[model samples]
Structures are given as C-alpha cells and as structure tokens.
Target: MSNESVRVVLVNTTHPGNIGAVARAMKNMGQSELVLVAPRSFPDEQAVWRSVGAADILENATVVETLAEAVADCHFIVGTSARGRRIPWPTLDPRACARQVLERRNSGQQVALVFGREDRGLTNEELQICNLHLHIPSHEDYTSLNLAMAVQVVCYELRMLALEGSLSSDAQSEWDAPFATAENVERYLEHLEQTLIEIGFLDPVAPRQLMTRLRRLYGRMNLDEMELNILRGILTETQKSLHKSSTAK
Candidate 1:
C-alpha cells in the first residue's frame, strides 16, 4: 500500500483545536492528506496555532462541502463511531480495520478514513456510507474518546501496519488476485437487497433498518469480489426458484 493514498477526513468539526490536533496526529504517522467537511471555523488563527509544527498539513488541507465529495474516489471508506447506533454496520477494532484498509490499498485502491463531529460523533446516516465502522476499545466506564485522540489511535495503527508488514499470508495471496473488485461487491449487494425485497424478506416501505443490519453483517465479513459474486448468484437462483413456484401454484 502506498503511504500517500490514505486520506483522513474530519466531518463537521466544531472545534478548531481538535482539527489542529488531528493534523498533528496525521503528521506524526506520516500521513499528509487532511480533509475537512463543512467545518465550523477553518482558517481560524487558533487552528494554525494549535497545529504547532504540523502547519504544513493544515496549510495543505482540503475543505469540502460534503463527506460524499471528500470520499467519492476512495475505494474503501471506514467511519469512526464510538457509540453503537441503530445502524447495522459491523464495528471493527482500529487494528483490524487498518489491516482491511491496507489490504485494499495493496491492490492500488485509494482509501479514506472518516471521523465525525467531536461532540456527538457520526450520524447513523453518515455511518451508513462507510463500508465499515471502527471503534477504539477503551475502559468501559469511560469510553468516550476525544475526537483527536481517536484520530491518533487510528492513525497509529495504520502507521504501525504500514511499517511492520503484518499482513497475513492469505491476504498477501489475495493481493495478487484481480477477480473481485469493490465495485462488484457493491453491485452484488444492490441485487441481493432487491431480491430480498421481491421475496418479501424486506419491506420496501421501511427498508433502511434491515438493510443497514445486513450491510453491517456483510461488511464485517469483508467479502472479496469472487465471494460476493457467488452470493449474488445464489440470490438470483433463489429469485428464479420463487418465481417458478408462484407460477406453478
């Protein structure tokens, strides 16, 4: 994985200091790209002041209107969320998530790690866009992590993974396989959901909850393209079988 391809994004940050601290964290881990989506007070003197020696990151930071714009081209998107919400996305520890990101990265895919607002963290809707949710394990009594600290933890893991080459042998083997792509997985997911809806397994009127759960379940497994295609084929056959049964009846 190229060190230059991972992007760290802060969404709707209300604190300039946190933004500065995030820049510092990214720099500490050799990460350069820092993107801010709709931050409250950018270009504030305080942000630069807090950046300290990492001013280059702050200076080169990209400010955008939406998170979608920030991560549109990224092949992998991971969202940091501390609190478990109603959404069904599978949560991963920072180390594990970093491994998954690095694997996709080794295939020459651009990856983005997204952090949300400092106070409330990411919204359920925002979390939905991410392929996975990353949570930092902390003392159960006091699990709320400062936004900058969370960024630091995630960046630290990524830096360590990149430097140490901890990838499993299986993962290394898949690195050479060109059969499955992220786009294929996404299309297969869409087809599976449609099949579920058609088979009365999903209610079209209130689909978000179930789909979110299913998304989380599948995201946790991190299915490669070939696996995703196999799943899609199963769904297609099931759909055909159901159709035949209804016609015969």
Candidate 2:
C-alpha cells in the first residue's frame, strides 16, 4: 500500500504542539498526507518546534474549516473515539483498524483516519459521518491518552502491518465497481432526506434519529458508486411520482 493514499485528519485540535508531534509520528510510519480541520492554531512556532526534522510534513499539511471539506474526496473514513455514545457505532480496535486501512489502501482507495480534540473525542455527529469507528483498548484505571500518543498508537499499527506484508496485494481485485466517495454519499443522503420530507414520511419538525439511523445503515453498507447511483435514481423517481400525484389531485 502506498503511504500517500492514507490521510491523517485532526479535527478541532487545540494544541499546536500536538499537531507537530502527530506529524513526527506520521513521518516515522511513512505517512505523508496530513489534514487539519478547524484547528485552533496552525503554522505556529510551537508546532514547528515539535515537528523538528519533519517540518516538511507541517509545511505540506492541508488546513480546512470543516471536516466535511477535509475528507470529501476520501472513499473510506475511520473516526477515532474513546467514549461511548447514545447510539453505538461499529467499533474496531487499533490493529483491526490498521488492517482495514491497509487493505483498502491496497485496493487503491483513498482513506482518512480522523482524530478529534485533546479535551474530548469526536462529537456524536462527527463520528456518525465516518464509515467506521476506531477505539484503542486502554486500561480502565487510566483511559485518557495524550492526543499525540493516540495518533502515534494508530500510526504505529499501520506501519507494522505494512512492514509485515500480511495482506493481499490487491484486496478488492474481484470487486468491479469503485466505492462511492464521501461527497457523493453526503449528496445521496441529502436527496434521501428531502424525498422523505416531501412524501410526509419524515416530519422535519421532530425528525428524531431517523436520519442518524439511516446514516449508520449506509455507512455499514459501504455502497459502491453503482449502488449509490441506483439509490439516488430511486429517490429521483419517488420525487417525480410525488409531484405527479399532487398535480393530479
């Protein structure tokens, strides 16, 4: 797997030093792409100081205002979380997470590993957008980990798996269609929501967890490009029928 295919994403990072240290960790593991989402401060002295010899990583990092902008092109997204949520997402340990990332990378998929702030992990809404959740199994007595350390743990796992060469050369060789990108998935979801509202199936006033559950369902499916287009076409046909019915009435 080419290391450049995988991106390390930090969301709302508060400390520049942590960003620098994460750069160092990524450099050690042969990963070069870094994405910062709404970081408090970037290109600061503290970040440069911590990055040390890996200044190139800091220089080349992409800074964006939102996570959606950061990973819109990525086909697979892995979110890091430490705490439980009201609605549990599909969770994978570090090794398993690394394995999956490597496997996808082998298939020429662009992947992003998303990390949250130091104070608290990813928000429920942010985590929902991810295709899979990654949780590091730490001791119960002291579960808290430094932001840089958490990133290092996951990066190390990826490096180890790559060096071992345990995975197949082409993980998705048999699969004919490419997986849909994050942007396309988001569009499909928006269309689905609008169609549901138009049909009076989902009351936008209350809404509840219908959309969240649907996001979870689709995230698990990892729908390919063809699959996503098929779903979108269905939504379009449904909307047209609704329009026809209203006109007839």
Candidate 3:
C-alpha cells in the first residue's frame, strides 16, 4: 500500500502543538499527507517546536474549513470516535482499522483517517460522514486518550502492517469502476432525500433517523461509480414521471 494514498486528517483541533505531534507520528509511520480541518491554531512556533525534525510535514499540510472539504476526494474514510452513539456504526479496533485502510490503499483507493478535536472529539454529525468508525479500545478506568496518542496508536498499527507486507491486494480488483468519492456520495444522498420528499415518502418536518439509516446502508455497500450513477438515474426518472403525472392532472 502506498502511503501517499492514505491521508491523516485532524478536525477542529484546538492545539497547534498537537497537530505538530500528529505530523511527527504520521511521519514515523511512513505517512506524508496531512489535512487539517478548521484548526484553532496553526503556523505557530509551538507546532514547529513540537514537530522537531518533522517540520516538513507541517509545511505541506492542507488546511480546510470543514470535514467535507478535508475528505471530499477520498473514497474511503475512517473517523475516530471514543464513545458509543444512539445508532452504533461499524466500529473497528485500531488494528482492524489499520488493516482496512491499507487494504483500501492497496486497491487504489484514497483513504482518510480522521481525528477530531482535543477536548470533545468528533461530533455525531461528523462521525456520520465516515464510512467506518475506529475505537482505540482503551481501558475502562481511563478510556480517554490524548489526541496525538490516539493517532500514534493507529499509525503504529499501519506501520506494522506495511512492514510485514501481509495485506491482501485483491479487494475491489475485479470491479469495473472505482468507488464513489465522499463528495459524490453526499451529493447522491441529497438527491435521494429530495426524491423521497417529492414522493411524499419522507416527511422533513418530522424527519427522524431515515436519512441516517439510509446513509449507513449505502456506506456499507461500498457503491462503485457505476452503481451510484445507476441509482441516481433511477431517482431522476422517478422525479420526471412524478412531474409528468402532476402536469397531466
């Protein structure tokens, strides 16, 4: 798996020093791409100082205003979450998460490993943007982990897998098309919601977990570009038919 295909993303980080340390951790694991989403502080001496010899990583990091922008081009996204939510996502331990990341990378997919803020971690809405959720499996007495520490743990697993060279590369190899990017998936979901509303199948006024559940279902499918296009075409046809029926009436 090429390290260039795997992106380490930090979202809404409060400390520049932590960002520096994360870059260091990523560098130690042979990773190069770093993305920062709405960091509270950056380009600070504290961050450069924390990076030590890894200052080059900081120099090339991409800073964005939102998580969507940080991973829009990425096809596979993994978000780090420490706590359980009302609707449990497909949670993976650090090792499993690392394996999945490498597998996707080997299969020619752009993958993003997303880390959240220092204090609160990723919001539920942010976590929902991810295709999979990763948990470090810390001890019950002290489950909370330092931001850099959490990153280091996952990065270490990735490094070990890369060094061993045991990961299978057959995943999605026979597929005719590439997987849909995160941005395209978001766009398709928006299109789906609009069609559902047009058909009176979903009530926006009392929208509960319908969209969330649909997102989960689609995320699990790992839909390819062709599959997504086919689904979108069906939605468009359905919309056109509804418009025609309304005009006739």
What TM-score would you give candidate 3 relative to the actual structure? 0.65
State how far residue 244 of model 3 sits from its true place (Å): 99
lDDT of all the models against the reference?
0.85, 0.90, 0.90
For model 3, state the Cα shift of residue 196 in Å: 90
Quote each prediction's TM-score. 0.64, 0.65, 0.65
TM match of model 2 to true structure: 0.65
Worst 10 residues of 1 by lDDT: 169-178
Candidate 2: Cα lDDT at 190: 94
- lDDT string for model 2 (11-75, tens) is 99999999999999889878889999989998889999998888999999999999899999998
Instruction: Spell out the clash pairs found in candidate 2.
Output: none
| Candidate 1 lDDT, 22-111, residue by residue in tens | 888888988888999999999777888888889999999999999999999988899998766765678899999989988888888889
Candidate 3 segments exceeding 4 Å error: 1-5, 166-249
C-alpha RMSD values across all candidates: 21.3, 22.9, 22.8
